[model samples]
Target: MDKRESKIPLIRFPEFKEGWEHKQLNELLKVSKKKNKDLKYSKEEVLSVSGELGIVNQIEHLGRSYAGASVHNYGLVENGDIVYTKSPLKENPYGIIKLNKGVPGIVSTLYAVYKVKDNNADGEFIEHYFSLDANTNRYLRPLVRKGAKNDMKINNEYVLHDRIFVPKKEEQKRIAHFFNVIDTKINQLKEKQNLLEEYKKGVMQKIFTQKIRFKKEDGSDFENWDNTTLGKVFKIFNGYAFSSKDSCENGVKWVKIADVGIQRMQRENVSFLPFEFRELHKKFLLKKGDFVIALTRPILNGELKIAEIDDFFHNSLLNQRVGKIISSNNLIFIYYFLQQQWLINSIEKNIAGTDPPNLSAKEIDHIKVSIPKVKEQEKIAKILSNIDNKIAKSINQIDNLKNYKKALLQQMFCY
Candidate 1:
């Protein structure tokens, strides 16, 4: 093969022996001029181009339509049409290209839609090819001129003038199908995770509300749950105020507010303190099985920013604005009970008008809770923990699959 035509991906199917062809995108695509000029598609049919979800219904994705008063001037996007969103994103500053694989819809004028020009190329292949951030950035960086407002300044037709390498039609189809299978697997895992979460939520509601109750080993009924304020059960205290300047490279892990996720600890961007600080901040130290909650902005997306310290975060120093809960009662039972929606509602009611939504030790202590006998608490906690373990496993599997797909994208496409 000629040197100019020798461009090929690092990984290719055994059946494909030839190098990929180098050509301008315009050779395979053309700007879509179709519009909703006749008012055939309403604002209800408006679509939004998402980097992760591709082209999706604007209302369904965002929970509301952001379309302007007029819809007749919107671009009409048909199935398999390529849409470019000119809006800048953190990952794709030059914008992103996505294929509309769903029903025909109308997109706002900010989006540029295009159609496949001929049988020489596949739309799905183009979509997958640009799916990699490096691929999209490299192709668009030089061509996308930024306006004063940081918006994309390139014309829709000009975007297709960039050169790209493409395999034969058959190879293109195979590659697209391969990635599609991976995507399907990811989606299936996500669905399973969602169902498990829903099941857990429902079961937790029933258990906490006393709609369902556990019994003794003999299957006889246990005593009714007793109501008590959180203060009567657990001693909640905020962590020590650690100075950022004192942070060290290696030593005790620092559990900052950002590290506390909903029912999980986020280890990304972790910071550490000097080993000597552990003795100085013994009161703020967190051990394994410790329960902690964010005092500032305690709730996110309707979920509490609370989690139990696991092995990975054991012996860590908790930073200020994070409350540590210590209890003589079954801590696991209390942790699960706090996750109940009704309990969260009670917390929200206390902090209703507070700006930035924070919680004080006094206010948290005043919150009421219901508890059963120690044996019943142990049984209930065991059941809920089992469900949580399954959810965590599903999440880990999804993350692994996503990482695998990311690796495949890097090797399967020529940069």
Candidate 2:
């Protein structure tokens, strides 16, 4: 490590030129051990601290507050209180440090709550630095000891004894303020993306249910729809079964049921077929705009993963238990229709009751669907696609913003 006296960050605000000094956590905050004596106290103020999200309302985290009525000896916490959970969370098998603000609440004894004692230290700034540093858990890991439960954890003593580097109050304010602004924009982008997705869902419902109708060349409403089986409209081709022995480092990339998502193939967990076998299964090769579905465990995620293939999707080989939906009619319409909520629920319930966990291609093809005129189908698909494109663009922007914030975090803090 560089000399503590010369502890400069990779990037600085230029206004302040002094090197940052390292300080143990005990110098800044100490564990707050105040407890609730009144079991029936209305100051239940239950809250939870998530690894990434920090402090949040308990109801929001657990659907309902786990601390119902009569929560005794619960730790009392106020706004600006810092909570350190020494146990492992879901994705974070280590621990998380957080600052609770505005959402004044109570947490369980399981959490070691601390309060800032030093006037110069900023709780939010400290929390942000620890969060940005990936080794935060490791730094605190030594504090952890085996508890009655299987999980190991640090106690209040260790939590209060730890230390970290903190800048002067003004500098801390500048850094915290910068991240806050970026966070606000990120939240706004996410909200816009979510609203657009919800709007598209409503639009899909309207079009599929005939609440909204498309017109003909003369501007007249299209004729009544015809009820037909999916098999009648489209040819469902199940993917080829390539053995594990045929799997290779490089060759045709094969998509499995696990790779399929309603929006698109994730393509991350995809396996590849041996180059030798690629020549024999040319017809099995998939191309752009090919609509596909997961056949086995079709309803595993509550809804099926239906997606249109990307033109440049690598190799694009289809594996068994996955299938491509083919139609001479408008392909986009079929893709959207399959995603209709009520239709999917009905299919899932049917499959859940009698069918094995696995659904066969024949069962899927037998499902009934409403077929509108080709022109009307084309119009509906176009409208939905436009909304989907907007949502996709917003998501891409949010991702870029998150990446930029990550880069800033890496540069703005010292080791």
Candidate 3:
């Protein structure tokens, strides 16, 4: 190895002095061999394996059935051991868990149990470290060779042999502790964001219900808002179906209704359709402020989202399942208003069919909304937008903390 000054900051602890030592993950850890039997239990312990954390009692998963249910034949797990969900939803590739509850439980064969060898590495540090890196899944992913595209099944054998890196013992604890603090801050921010969302919801309900009123330039009330159908205020432009084969490696961005995530549109990692496909789906060209709502899904079945295309989103095409709303009303105000619990409930009530419920343009237009003057709508939109900005900032802070924790993990272990 070429001798060079390390660019990374080194920690000086009371008990440790060396910069750090590197080692293979197999050197400091061993995988569990206790096989889980298929025997069923009448009064099972209700154990579940957390993706980053080890096995915990039934309460952790809220008593959800895991891997088709089996008895407690598997070896018991302790705190700080790493256990993963063998089958995870595709969108959520990493699954979940970075900490474990020290509780009595057994895991299914679907879970791979990794425990740090005695004092060779800090279990807490390793747990936090492995939790952060998606790279670990690089090896673990291929093991999941079967199941649905959304939920693929993985085996323990694959995870147990997966190679990982580790750092010196002292560095492990420091890094884990450092990341844990950052994680706490992230969780706190998330809680604050949730509160802000709740506050906005409450305000929306009050403002729309006439509990709070808006005044005009003449200082007169806008009057009890008129009850209007959706079609009256806006025209719904349904997107055209573009063939999947027409999608290109790099071309004009296409917004499938699925591109609208649970909260906002995912501008990055967007799929692209070629110019020829765009010609075929010319009517689906999306404007900057267009509200694209998913009309079909069990995934986002009850979800309504507004897409805010940035400068980069020019020439993007919207998919047929997405309905673009061009409103005479303030679009942001309408978007948040639809996000209100009451509106979602109302829309959900009118929903028909069981096998993947779909909403039609007529059904969308029939959804009733209390309409205020355009000016008043703009005012309401401004207030809600401020709250959303705060929420967005908090969300960003959470993301930063998660990134910090992940970085700390990579540095903590010696492999």
Best of the candidates, lDDT: 1
Q: 1-415, model 1: which lDDT tens digit per residue?
A: 1125657788888998888878788888999999999999998999998888899999999999898999999999999899999998989999999999999999987899999865878899899988988888988998999999998898998898778888888898999999999999999989999999999999988888789988899989999877888788777678888999999899999898899999999888899999999998888889999999998899988889999999999999989989898787888988887887877888888887888888886776877777898999999999999999999999999999989988998888775
Evaluated against the true structure, the overall lDDT of model 3 is 0.64
Residues 1-415, candidate 2, lDDT per residue (tens digit)? 2225547888889898887877777777887977777643343368788776678887777677777456567787788888877667754565778888656667777788888875877877877777654747655656666567746566686665655566787898899888889989988989999999899989988888889988887988899998998778787788888787888888778888878886777856767777656678878888888888887767655677788888656447788888788788899988888787777886676567554466665655677888897888899899999998999899899899988988988888876
lDDT of 3 by residue, 1-415 (tens): 1223333333334565554443445556677665435443322555675543345565555554443444546654556666666556343364543335565456665555667676778776666655644654654554456555655465444444444554566666776677668766877888899999889778888987878888888998776688988668777677777668887898878888677665578765778887676676667777676677777751354555555665566668987777776777888777777776666766666665545667666655787777888889888888888998999899898788777666655544332
Clashes of each: 0, 4, 7
In terms of TM-score, the best-performing candidate is 1
Q: Is candidate 1 or candidate 2 better by lDDT?
A: 1
How does candidate 3 fare on TM-score? 0.76
Error of 2 at 15 (Å): 1.0
If both were scored by lDDT, which would come out higher, candidate 1 or candidate 3? 1
Q: List the residue pairs that clash in candidate 3.
A: 23-415, 24-415, 166-413, 166-414, 166-415, 167-413, 167-414
lDDT of each: 0.88, 0.77, 0.64
In the order shown, what is each candidate's alpha-carbon RMSD?
2.2, 3.0, 5.4
